[model samples]
Target: MATCAEEVSKTKLVVAAIDFGTTYSGYAFAFQKDYSSDHHSLRIYGIMSKNGCSQKAPTCVLFNPQGKFDSFGYDAENRYAELTLTNEHQDWYYFRRFKMMLYNNPNITWHSILKDDKGKSMNAIKVFSAIISYLRQETLRNINERVANVGIKENEINWVLTVPAIWSDQAKQFMREAAKKAGIHSDQLDIALEPEAASIYCKHISVSRRERQETHGAEGVGLEAMCPGTKYLVLDAGGGTIDITVQRVQENGTLHQVYMANGGDWGGTKVDEAYEAFLEELVGQNIWEAFKAKYMDSYIDIFREFETKKRTISPDIENRITFTVPPVLRDVYEEMKNSPLSTTQGHHRNRKLIWKGDRLRVDVTEAKKLFETTCALIVAHVERILDKEETAGTSDILMVGGFSESPMLSNAIKERFGHTKRVIIPEEAGLSVLKGAVLFGFDTRVVSLRVMKHTYGIQSSSLFRKNLDPDITKTMVKGKLYCEDRFSKHVKKGQSVRIDEETQTIDYHPLDDREEMAVKVYITDKYDPEYCDTELCSYIGQLLVCLPMDVPTSDRGVKVNMKFGGTELSVRATVMATNQTTHAEFRLLE
Candidate 1:
């Protein structure tokens, strides 16, 4: 009999699906095997990881001023000061969300982040890339070094990448590009919609009481337990963006969502920004106005001083901030009845004024308000999706996202769906999508990839409409080719096909023979090419199918054969023509 581990590894593919999230990134790999003593059937073992790291990794990076990498994760965060990062370089090192920038702006290139040995902050893609690259290396290390029991070769591992549902195809392509640069294998690469991945992952953990026993491995749908046609609203709040998707359970376990919405760019990072702005405003602006107005340049460290005081104290209603003022304080505001400050000890050529009190506290309340505002925006958007789903007859919502981890947000969801049914939030909310990415990767047939020009096979002229029959469902055949019949495969509506090699056989003498019953290669749905939607199905490029000199163009349905490149397809088709009858070979391209 196969070992239990072998059995578990049967259903699960021993590969990792990386969720390169904007705020956080993580990977999950499943190990499957055959474990039945009587009947040999595959069993699925879940993803394994080290320590408290359950298949997820922090997405922060750090480097030093010497352009040398300092450290990453907890290490850099702790000993930031020792790193001596180049904080002076405006373009070099910084720690901030670049994902939004990637989408919103085309000019911004990813530069790694850096921080001093104290770990303040820096700019560099090296830090981010290092963190990402290291995690990838760890995955390989565990597989090659520790995947002893798993029956898979090192190169066999496939990787599925998940991205936001609202992301543009161009943006997703860029992600794919970054992954390529990161050394992730291209064939192993795939992108899953984050919401869908989370939904799939959440389904595995179990949601309701009535439906639980039918757990048939990772891809097993909770069809039996999908809460029987209940509605759910996903209020996904994360470190960077918040997304909301409303899903409805069909007779089968699949979730069909009608509405998808979200944009909480104001996540945890926003809170930090709000706090920083508060400090920058009070100490930098307010104090500087008073100092600069008095012509005292000695107080250069005014902003830094305010930062120190703010950090030393915690939030307190009774005044959490306090810093001693320099003796020159009397010389400043009260000195010439103009803004000013005096030095404390007067050690050098001159000392400037220093004053601090309750400045940090002034922004605390405002910061909290900003945080709440971002959270509220996320919640409101989720509610809107739910409302739209209800209109579309989609009554169930499966809540998933990093922000769903927030108790504050969770309560809001419970209250929103209180009168109705309820919302389902996974225990490891953020990781749900990471897990779902695996599920999505495991099932590539149904969830095939959709790409721009690369994955698309364009038909020269789609005959969607015909003048002869307004109601004829198949309007494509109405327009017959006068010169030649060309075969187009590897492309169709809602179908995926790639052109391994794209080629066109030209009617070389069409221009020369324009008056000799010339062939006009035009795109259209109507039998009369002139009546088609020329703007949409117009001729982008054309190839003329020339009949032999002995045959007339009007009488010949010249068959043109074009073949290019090698890509997967459900069915393949070929068109062949010589002098007379048109011949074609067709296959389904899934």
Candidate 2:
């Protein structure tokens, strides 16, 4: 009925976003037609599990003894539990909440080793690739079911992977390589900064404004309430890290970052750790260890229940919060304490511990204290950002993340900043990053500007000056005096970089008679440095350029270009003689 060209032109553009979080992971996508007509209708969904439909799946992976991926998410948890029953889990690799490894790793690379829960080590790239592959397959199946008679092609779809804005370039590149191994082409993949993605999605959605106005005052309801150039702060509190950034809205609905992205490991999972510590303190450490070893399924169950309860807890709640204790843990506690867990024992000796059926009830005040450690850190970081000179005039705070859904956290933030700034928590704050990533895939230019996290540059030689430069860096090249380790800055720290902005071009020549040149890329926190060996500076990666075989050493000069505006750094080198150009493959230092 239609020509091949017509049929080809009818191919749809689908955007799929994979939000790989530290404690959880999920995928969300939208068809271009649906997103363009009405952005509000584009509801982001995640993989369904037997337990229920959730916005994210637990970021847990289970691999067999052969080092092959067995299952992921709840399935992985269930499989590991089954294996634990037979004492076979020791040989299998089970990784859970492992995404933070990249963030904490100072020298993250593609060849890094990731240790699992049992201390079993595997290639980080393989581990990430397996998880990404599972998500991709599951998402593709879901897409097939959603659309009828409209077959999707890989080229027609754009994929966006979300990464923490605070992560280093090596970490981001590691994710990119892992995605490529999972079958996504490098050209089709776009990396989205978590906080920026969340901001973009919240900017378009009006529900947050409507809900805020209905609950709080009508002032500072949404982006529409503020005039153009008005600034606001976005706090993306996830399971592993809380990233904060200040951004101003542009006239064309674009966004510009006002401050560099910053935050720490104070996230929702910190509260879980506090709760676990409470149990360890309530019962002796030996008993707690035994309980964990013998009743891991029960341990997971307790936390799973706590996860649900934690979200609903508010500072105003009068009743004591209760959690179901596994029978085995209860037995262990009794055996260790030599008495039953009740109101008159352990840390809360004066308070009454109500035992309703198999559940342990704790006072609301005690339960609320568990959240204080993490919530306090979040508030402190937000205040620090607000105190910065760059964040001046920021009157609104947009809180989005799984942790932001916690009633206690919301109230704490509101109580602290309610007088000076309006706090807006969007509905389903957990899915904001995933959905916003999908929006980013559709249009990467939504975030018009970003602040450079670090000063990126290359190590090159410059003519050594007697008075201006140090003697240690002086070297002789081709009988010419030079500073061998001179820091050639491509982008300075805290510089405002617009989307697609390219760094200034610099010319480089082969150091030796060899026909190849190596460009060493380095990053530092210092404002400006004369040498790359300064404090807080580290070598990240290198780019190799090969000259034509017949070209002379003098003609082997290459023009190097670097771009630091996006989530990752990009480098391109062109031979000056033949005009041949090639993208540099950055190899991270081991």
Window of ten residues with lowest summed lDDT in model 2: 1-10
Query: Which portions of model 2 miss their true places by more than 4 Å?
Result: 1-12, 43-50, 207-210, 213-227, 334-352, 355-357
Alpha carbon deviation, residue 119, candidate 2 (Å): 1.7
Report every candidate's CA lDDT. Answer: 0.45, 0.82
lDDT of 1: 0.45
Distance from true location, Cα of 465 in model 2, Å: 3.2
Best candidate according to TM-score: 2
lDDT of 1 by residue, 1-590 (tens): 00112123234446477766665666666643221231112232334333343334445444545666545443433343232232233322334245664445433234433353234554434444555566676667665555567546645666666667655334454555556667865556666667767776655555632223322344434433455465455555666666555555545555554343345465555644554554334335555355433332223223224323332333233332333333332444444455543223232222122233322123234423435665576667765655652435544445566656555455555666645644566666767787777665655432223212221222333333445423423323334423122223222222222222323433232212232222222233332232222353433222323334444544333434433211111112222234343322221100
- Estimate the TM-score of every prediction: 0.56, 0.92
Give the per-residue lDDT digits (tens) of candidate 2, residues 195-297.
Answer: 9999988887744854567566777764344457879999999999998889999998889998999899988989999999987876678999988776767
Give the RMSD in angstroms, all C-alphas superposed, for model 2: 4.3
Error in Å for residue 493 of model 2: 0.9
